[model samples]
Target: MVSLVASSFMQVACAADSEGTSPNNQDKPASSWDDISDKLKVATTKGLSKLSWGLEWLGYKSGFGEQCTFVEHPSLAVRKHLQANLKAQDRAVDVLVASIEAWERTHAKDHAPLVLALTGPTGTGKTESSNLLAEALFKWTKRLDHSDKDSPSGLLVFRGEDFSDNYTNPVSQYQEQIKSRLAEHLFRCSGKALVVFDEVQKVIPHTLDVLTSAMSSNAHLTYHRGGVERRIDTADVVFLLISDIGVAKMEQLLIQYDDRRHVPATQLENDVKRALDAQWTRLQFGKMVRQVVPFLPFEPQHIVLVIQAKLDQLSEYYQGVYWKSLAFDPALAPHLSTLESMLYIERRAVVRGVDVRKVFAKYGARNVETGPLQQLKSKLMRYARPWNPEAQFTVRLMPDERTIEIVACVEARANDQDKANEDGGGGAIDTLSCVSRWQGEFT
Candidate 1:
């Protein structure tokens, strides 16, 4: 293992040196031996850190000692991400920050894990918020680190439907399985795991009792099987429970306030907790939850921003793939307005003399990506060609509102223009022609 780590360190050092100096700088003076040695030392340190992390993950001790710890304070990163990407979720973001800060302060003491319940309507950023938290906590790279069936990347997900009682299997069986799985994973992770339980309302009471017990324990999670007792420390673990339990009441509150910004966050959270408590009277885990965060519905303007952001991302991707400049027509605002109408539904409630109104997505942002944006990607792929890699291509919506046209701006050179004039044709300096047309329904 030492030799393998050393070899990796050397490779990383060489790669870093090569990437630092481009081909254009080849004629410059070579770096001194001292500089190269410093780079090697830096690469070796990084390599050892990664190696230590791997060893620790596999339940092995590393020679590096405490330097191998991977958990980080994610307050700043998470706050910035939520502020920039998530809209109309100030209360949720605040609760998450407070929970993390509190955990940081008391993690050394033996205590139960922090349990947060995220309750809201569908497509209200519940999943996105959890993913962000995971990324920040573990410093995870989406492309490099991923969760699979065989192994978890510090983030474990469990669906409520998977634990439901069936004819062949009973709820008690699922409870035991979950307990075992949690114990093993928590042990391997050294209690630094972020476990997400989605659709919590669908989870049977029997299974929920098991989960509640795990969170309500002190310092360690104990499991006994085959007359053998195993205890795993869980002081750093966090449980994120996602549900749509009080969506109706939340919408009603939004309506009462006339604006989501005016809704009292404390009142909203208390109301949701009461609703959850009423529904799950058997376990009553609602009262035990550390915090209850609410995700409000999205307005029309927020939906427009989301759609535009998706298009912007697609444009950046195609620019690299097609090696051409991709541009959107400025006249797309009308089309975006039409799309916003199709994406969300409006609800109204009358309280006193005020008419409360709220808007939310019919199908969440995930559907938007899989539905219209996916089709848009396919159309771009079918039409985009690298014939003139330096030319600019404009994407436009047709009058029918269902078709898209890719128009290429082809500039006529002086020689081409002269030839055209000699051949008895109009000599145009700049020519715009429709290269490809894609006709499809949105959604």
Candidate 2:
């Protein structure tokens, strides 16, 4: 009797276990995020997952075959914000990206309701981050692998040029375009978009006024064509407006004087308020800040970080074998060094381009044939190794003459091939000879 009862208990236990393990169990799969705000909070508080980015980049290149450039620092920050929609465990936020995340966390909703107004100096990556976020949004929806070479079909990028043609009739022209784009944006992916407006200050007031109403009132813009007018809703949109308006004011103060010197917070607030009330006359910002969103001005460190980050990104992009064959030419090494230095100086120059070569020529770069430059190029090319067609490389430089100023005469190239010196061996020739090939993209 006892053995029979124990056998029956085992069978009941097995039945219970089977029921729990069944596919129709009570717990559903963890996928769709009922509240995207929570996911954003995780992103803002914990920064982005680098592993995810690596995977995405791999997929983008290998799966999609589309060309994508990654910018570090601000670019990384932008990438995080763009991909913030994805949720996972073990998220970690970096100190460098705290402000942006904090701002996002402070304002979250079912849709991307935050309209981040990032204001900073020229190199601060405000524009970069905004662009990345928009791009990521497009990529996310297309579900195309990063490694796939095929380009996504639905991409609507709005640049200042798009609105430039209608500058004279600002409101009317802009209204038409804005309405159309908005319609398209909603028709396909209603609440799942990343819209960015760079240099918001450049936007005309009347046009800005429309954007302001659309954002604040969450109203759809209406347009009339052939005596027909239509209105749409815009409650689930993520709008990003970037500007350099406060940059000049911020940089001059920060660089000239360590921002340790503080104006009373109240005083700054009052000044901002005064500026806000005077918006109608100023007409530059269209009362956007005073009316629409917060204006966050980046500090000096932010500028330095952005510039350094851009350089690092460029270096990484150029590190591969793209230019291996050219870089390895025994005859081209010295020219590459000169080119690199020239680019650095050119960046510092007031005006850039071929004039940079003239500067080098004026410095008595010799330009005589078979001169020190030839030797240097040969030696460097040898060091670079043989040309590898499969190698990827990047070249970018500014045409600045000063690049050659510090070089010893032994390294200078000649101005002419056959021409000799005025006094024979003194080595005189054309001032502009031994031209080096230019490589890399110039901004």
Candidate 3:
């Protein structure tokens, strides 16, 4: 564990060293190491200066804590995200937003935090909704940290899967990390920060015990930093545990209901409460949490909305890309949307059990692939490929062999249309696809 921490720092040192280089900047005057280091320090902080060093060892740009003067208020896009993506979760969203806003308004000198537990089955927007909330309050999703599943930030994340095996790394090491981070963030934020333990069910009881002091209202946490046990205050920090423990069975239990869209919030909350009871009791941290908000299994209508929302995200993303009218072929969107909806649910209450982001991520060239996926990946335009600067894109998935075809249509540019036509491959559907049976959908 210590070695892991050291390696993380080493990576940061490597990044700092590389910042001084440039292939073409050799002609430019080079700044002294001190000047460069100061500039790098300024750049390393991505707006949030108060809590910058919490993740300094990791070399990622840092975020400001809650109490930091530079933190941003929620954006319109974040509000729109909540309004568009989350359905039938009005209760949860309302409570969360209300509480956080209230916390922000309070003038109390002492610390008091709002703790929430977001529980639900897969693909029901629990995480997305949380992101929406975070974005609204924090200005950007990246500042929330661990938003990418594995990151360091004021919004600390504990993956339950990793914590389940304490034998591999001493739990005390993790405890130390969590304790120090929480203390730093809370102090920076004036006793307020969001800490998430995702996939909470996978964490062992003893490991969770580490969080008790941090969760308690007293905000007292005890851990050894330098062979000395130290205490810190966490009273202003909000703790959110995202759990999927009883969600599968809960879906099964709700299958007989006819009006799936209107599952009572109280009823869903109760279900989450029941599932969390056994573990909370075993872990002895049941009373610390303020509320259990259930993310119900996505219904067909929910899936439909989610798919459209996801597609819009894709469209909005590539819309700004250099030279292309990027869009899901209107003809093909319906088919892909249908497939996305089918993937979210299960036998009783299921939807795409997987995140749709992974699909959108396939377009990036950085990731490695194998077999036909690799072949399909190879079809993409390289970083510097030049077929036609004024080309448009339409994404299409052929029915068989799980083929995804990127259809690029070169458009007539006033200056180059004649040249384009003369060169051939002109004004036609240029197909980029691979041959393969992509069986990535849920069985």
Candidate 4:
């Protein structure tokens, strides 16, 4: 490959020299060989970079490609998604959108990546908000499209636990590994990237030194590999550092304000920043963070909305799989009641001035989805059969409250004996019978 490239460069240089010198005889000075060589070098670099980008777009893994560009203004789309999907995170959504808009407008003049520190309790829509931002910025149709072979989406995710302190390996080794991985992705994507570090509190502060340096203004990531040094620009990149640090403070602020929307953004951010600074006192990378966005704990109302959304999603999925329409009886009121009972062992917790929000905060929206919603989906898959396309199934909480029952509604005529046993004395009506019932423990 080296010889071939060299020969190609020589041929192009020779062709350019011939053309430049042959310029219709008189008035023009002869072109210098050095000038021809320089032009050829620029052309070769551009051609190779284009080729690498093209190959990557076609689903081939090119080691290095053109930098990924962002949408001109992704804040609108991001705001829309956050408002429509994420529940009870108005403050987070506002700060995130504003920060992104500002970055988009001034990124060319900025020296480093826009670093956002997302601090909150678990399952408070921190990760979900990150995903929404990635989708909007990259123009992805779905969250999973980031991994699609045809799409050259510039989103990279890292877990802090993966770089945590270990007895066997030195912290410096972990730092080097992170630097190498980040450099490779940044070079491949051409510095147009969104890098996310989830659970950053779990990582050793020393392990993130590379990130701190790369995120510094006027600093570029220098990757040394195969005897070549590649400088990856961080100006166009965005970094999201998600952690649960200072969640207690955030929760307290929320309680004090009675609502997250009422909490002063400046104060909330300062508290989170202080907590982060205290935790990472040795490294003090917290100073590099541009915005400290707080994802407040989920309230009961938010949890209910989350539960309803999950049910709707699950119902849509089951409908397609079963070839039958599924409906929830009286919506999500019963489900919420069941959830509260399962979450709180003692009813006095609510009576003793402990609001249900505490329970909602403890589990968060993610737990509700993964726990009760997952079990509900599993039960439907196991018991709900697609026997009749015309039949509709209703999911309702049984009288016992702990048991969930699936009832099938079939349209048929009832005789005298059947009427006596079934719904009163109806001649022709829909008869409902229990299809399946099971007691689910929401944990």
Query: Could you say which candidate leads in lDDT?
Result: 4
Global lDDT of each candidate: 0.69, 0.41, 0.54, 0.71
Give me the runs in candidate 3 sitting further than 4 Å from their true place.
1-81, 84-92, 102-110, 128-132, 139-153, 166-174, 184-190, 222-231, 320-322, 337-389, 395-443
The residue-by-residue lDDT of candidate 4 on 61-180, one tens digit each, is 343434465665678877887887786778889899999889877776776679999988788888888877877787332224556544326788899888776566468888878889
Number of clashing residue pairs in every model? 0, 38, 12, 2
Error of 3 at 278 (Å): 2.2
Give each model a TM-score: 0.72, 0.44, 0.59, 0.71
- lDDT per residue (tens digit) for residues 179-208 in model 1: 888876676566678889898887766666
Write one digit per residue (lDDT tens) for candidate 3, span 1-443. 34444554466566545654654434443554565566555544433443343444233334333332214443343445577656655666665666566655652554656677887765455666665555444422343335545222245556778777745756776666666766666555555456777887777666666777667666677756577776766665667888766765556545545564465656766776887887788766778887776666555444334444555555565453633565554444334434422333244333346222111211111111222223323444442135444556556656763445566666442344555688874444434432222223211
Could you give me the TM-score of model 3 versus the true structure? Answer: 0.59
Residue 234 Cα positional deviation in candidate 2, in Å, after optimal superposition: 1.8
Q: What lDDT score goes with residue 46 in model 1?
A: 74
lDDT of each residue in 141-180, candidate 2, tens digit only:
3444666543322333455545544436567768667767
Most accurate candidate by TM-score: 1
Better of 2 and 4 by lDDT: 4
Q: Which prediction has more favorable lDDT, 3 or 4?
A: 4
lDDT of candidate 4? 0.71
| Model 3 accuracy (lDDT, Cα) | 0.54
* Prediction 2 global C-alpha lDDT: 0.41
